[model samples]
Target chain A: MTDDSIGAFRDELIDSGLVIDAGVEGLYGRTLAYEEIVSGIIALTTRTGAGDGAMAVHFPPLIPRWLLERTDYLKSFPDLTGSVHTFGGDDKRHARLLALVDGGHDWVEVLEPAEVVLRPAACHPVYPLCTGGPLPTQGRRFEVQGWCFRHEPSADPARMLCFRMHEFVYVGDPDGAGAHSELWLKRGAEMFESMGLDVDVVVANDPFFGRAGKFLAANQLDDALKLEFVSPVSSTETRTAIGSVNRHQDHFGLTFGIESADGEVAHSACFAVGVDRTALALLKRHGLDPGRWPAEVRARLWP
Target chain B: MEEEIRQILEEHGRLPVPMADLDNNADLYEAGMTSHASVNVMLALEDGFDFEFPESMLRKSTFESVSAIEAALTSLVGTPVE
Candidate 1:
C-alpha cells in the first residue's frame, strides 16, 4: 500500500478507539477492546498447539548480550538488533552527563552497554539450553512466548518496534526438524483460516542486513529455509506476514554445540505467530468490535 | 585461479571434507559451508582479488560452486590473473 494510505488506516484505528497514539510512528497503546482481541488470539494458539506435547517455556524480554554475540545474528541483522544500555557511572560522570543534558547536547556517551539485550525472537533464548549435550531419542519440543524487539520503525501499522510472539520449537535430527517445519506450515494456515482470515503460506526470508546479507538471503531462499503466512490487514495490495515457519539446518546446533542422540549435530525449526499482527488482521477481517464476530470464530476463540 | 579459489575455500569455507576430493562444480554450501562461513569467504575473496563485488553478484548462485566463484570473480576483475 502507498504510504499515505497506510497513515490513513492508522488514523482510522485511532479514531475507532482501538489503539492509542503513543507519538512514536510504530509504537501504539492498545485499548481494552484491542487487548481483549490479542488475549483471545493467544489463547486460541495455546489451545491449537496443546496436543503437540510441547513443554511450555516462558521467558522475560531480555537475554544475555554475550549469547547474542555468539550467534550469527549480529552479522546477519546488525541493523535490527537492540542492545540494552544503562547509566553506570560514578558521581563525577553523572555530573558530566547532567551538564551535557543541561546544555542540550547529546548525552548518550554516558550510558554503557548492559549485560542483556532485547530478545529478538521467542525461540532464541531456548537454544542455549540445548547446548553442550545431545537430545533424547525422540528429540525435544518447546512452546515459548515472549515480547521480541526489532529496530524497524515504519509507517505500516503491522511493523512495530516490539510485539509478542508465540513459537513452537523443535530440535532434533534433520528428518525430525524437516517434519516439524512441514507439520506447522499446514497447521498455521489452518488455524488462520478457522479464525475467518484468508491467508497464504509462501516461501520467505529474513531481512538480512547490508551487502553481504543479499547473498545470505538468497541462500536462505534457495534452500527454502523460511515460510511466511501472509494476509492483507492494513491494505489488500500489500499483505502483512502474520506468522512464519523457519528451518535452521544445524545452524544453531553448530553454534551452540547441540547434538542428537546419535551424536550428529541437531537441526532446529520453529513456527511462530505474531500475536499483535494476528489481532490486527482479525479486526480488519471481522470488524473493529470482537463481540460481533462470527459465531464460529468467537466460539473457537472464547471457548 | 581455480587453485586460488580452492585455497580460500580451504581456509574459510569450513567444509568438513577435504577440498582435494571435490570437483570444480561441487556445491560448496552443500559440502558444509554455513552462512557465517559464506560471509567470511565473500570478504576474503574481495580482499584476495582487490575488487568489491557489486550488489548484483551478491547471491547464492554466484558462490555456489568453485566454477561459479571463478565466473563471478572474472566478471568483477576481468580474466583470472593466473
Candidate 2:
C-alpha cells in the first residue's frame, strides 16, 4: 500500500473506535468491540480440532533474563528486545531524579535493569518449562497466550509494539515437529480463508541481525523452516504476515535440554496467531462495521 | 573484476575477516555478510556499475560469493568480467 493509504488506515482505525491511540507509535488500546472480535476469533480458531490434550498455560508479559538469554533472543534481536527496569534509588537519588525531571531533563537514568525482560514471544517460555526431560512417544503439545513486546514502533496499525499472540507449541522428534508445523501452516490458512480474508501462505524468515545473519536467513528460507500466513491488512499490494508456523529443528530442544523418547535432542515447532493483526485485517477487509460483514464470517467469529 | 568486487566487499560487505583475506570463491555470507549488509553491497555495486539488479537476480545465490557477485555483475553489464 502507498504511505498515504497506510496513514489513512491508521486514522480510520482511531476514528472508528476500533483502536484507542495510546499516544505512542505502535502502541494501541483496543475498544471493547475490538477486543471482543479479537478474543472471539482467537477462541474459535484455537477450538478447531484442539482437543489434542494440549496443556494450556498463560504467561506474564515479563520473562526472566536468564531464560531469555538461553533462547538467544538477544543475539538475534537485541534491537527489538525490551528489558524491565526500575528505580532502586536512595532518597538522595530520588531528589536528583525529581530535580532532573523538574528541570526537563531525562530522569530515567535512575532506573536499573530488573531480573526480567518483556517477553518477546509467546513460545520462548514454553521451551524452558518443558526442559530437562525426555518427551512422550507421542510428544508434548502446549497452548499458550501472552502479551509480547518488541521495539519496532511503526505507524502501521498492524505492527503493534505490544500485542497478543495465541500459540500452540509442539516438542518432540524431528518428524513430529516438522509435521506439526506443516499441518498448522495449512490449518492456519484455512482458518483465515474461512473468515472471508484473502490469505497467502508463503515461505518466510526472521529478521536476523547483522551480516552473519543474512546466511542464517538464507539457511532458514532454504530449509523452509518458517511459513507465514499473510493477508492484506494495511495495503493490498503488501500483505502483512499476521501469523506464522515455525519449525526450529533441534535448536530449542538442544539449548534447553529437551529430548524425545529416543534420548536425542527434540525438535520444536510453534503455530502463533497475531490476535491484533488478524482483528485489524478483518476490519480492513470487511469494513469498520462488523455487523455488516458476511453472515458466515460473523457467525464464525461471533457465534 | 575480483579486485573491484573485493573493494566493495571490503568497504560494505561487513564481513568479520578482511575482504582481502577471503577466498574469491568462498561464500561471503559464510565469511559474515548479513542480509542487511548485502543490501549495502548491492547498492554499491549498482552505483559503481550503473546497472540495476533485476528482481530475478536478487536471490541468496546471486551474492553468495565474490565470484557469484562478479558473475551477476558480468551478466548485468552483458560483458565479460573486467
Tens-digit lDDT string for candidate 2 (A208-238): 7764455557667876878899899987779
Give candidate 1's fnat, 2 decimals.
Answer: 0.68
Tell me the tens digit of each residue's lDDT in model 1 across A193-247: 9999989987887788887888788878877889999988888678889999999
Error in Å for residue B14 of model 1: 2.5
Stretches > 4 Å off in candidate 2:
B1-82
Model 1 CA lDDT for position A8: 78
Off by over 4 Å in 1: none
**Candidate 1, residue A181: CA error in Å?**
1.1
- Clashing residue pairs in candidate 2 are A211-B33, A211-B34, A214-B35
Best-fitting candidate, scored by lDDT: 1
Which has the greatest DockQ?
A: 1
Q: How far out, in Å, is residue A202 in model 2?
A: 1.0
